[model samples]
Target: MINNLFSAVSAAAAQEHFDELLRRPGLRIERIVSQGQASPTGFWYDQPQGEWVVLLSGSAGLRLAHEPSERVLSPGDFVEIPAHCRHRVEWTDTSAPTVWLAVHFDAV
Candidate 1:
């Protein structure tokens, strides 16, 4: 049963924040669990997957590597993490569920 459609959360696109939404074969979706007030500190993964994160609820900080840019995301803001791109979090709300959606992929 799908009621309260108005209460359902949705984001059209990651305007100005995401690099590019690449959709193709061999791509996979990964689970990102950032419970409480914790985040990865400017790290890079040894893989070919780009992460596109959308802030489902609460607030969080997304810092880009080699770039002097820090984005504080609310409930609807989204971001695209490039493949092997190093990054870190500047801050996150301590009293809220910081839910996020991450999509990963490999470049051909």
Candidate 2:
């Protein structure tokens, strides 16, 4: 089967959308769409699995717990977050949908 990642997105969505694309032992892939969504104040994500994510469209602000400043991510930008690394989404573009391709995997 063939599918397009940029299809079926809701531009007027009030909250971020997460779609699971594939899953297998020790690995998972997802398509995330965000529009003006951000992590709650003082909140952070600490996951057991590491994540490698790429910005496909629009832009976003990503902050790591150990970093003093947020990293601005543009289209084609990518990041690898180790397991147990605390991170948060500072913000996403409000004028357009920010598409992200995220892969979560167990550390070897």
**Candidate 1 residue lDDT tens string, 1-108:** 654312423233222122222455866543343434444454534446776777767688777776788788898898878877877777665554455666776654
Question: Which 10-residue window in model 2 sums to the lowest lDDT?
Answer: 7-16
Q: List the residue pairs that clash in candidate 2.
A: none
- Point out where model 1 deviates above 4 Å: 1-25, 31-35, 40-47
lDDT on C-alpha atoms for all candidate structures: 0.59, 0.96
lDDT of 2 at 6: 97
Residue-by-residue lDDT tens digits, candidate 2, 1-108: 899999998785898999999999999999999999999999999999999999999899999999999999999999999999999999999999999999999987
The CA lDDT at 85 in model 1 is 81
- Candidate 2, after superposition: displacement of residue 107 in Å? 1.2
What's the alpha carbon RMSD for model 1? 8.4
- Alpha-carbon TM-score of each model against the true structure: 0.62, 0.98
- What is candidate 2's CA lDDT for residue 71? 99
Q: Model 1's lDDT to the true fold?
A: 0.59
Candidate 2 lDDT for residue 7: 97
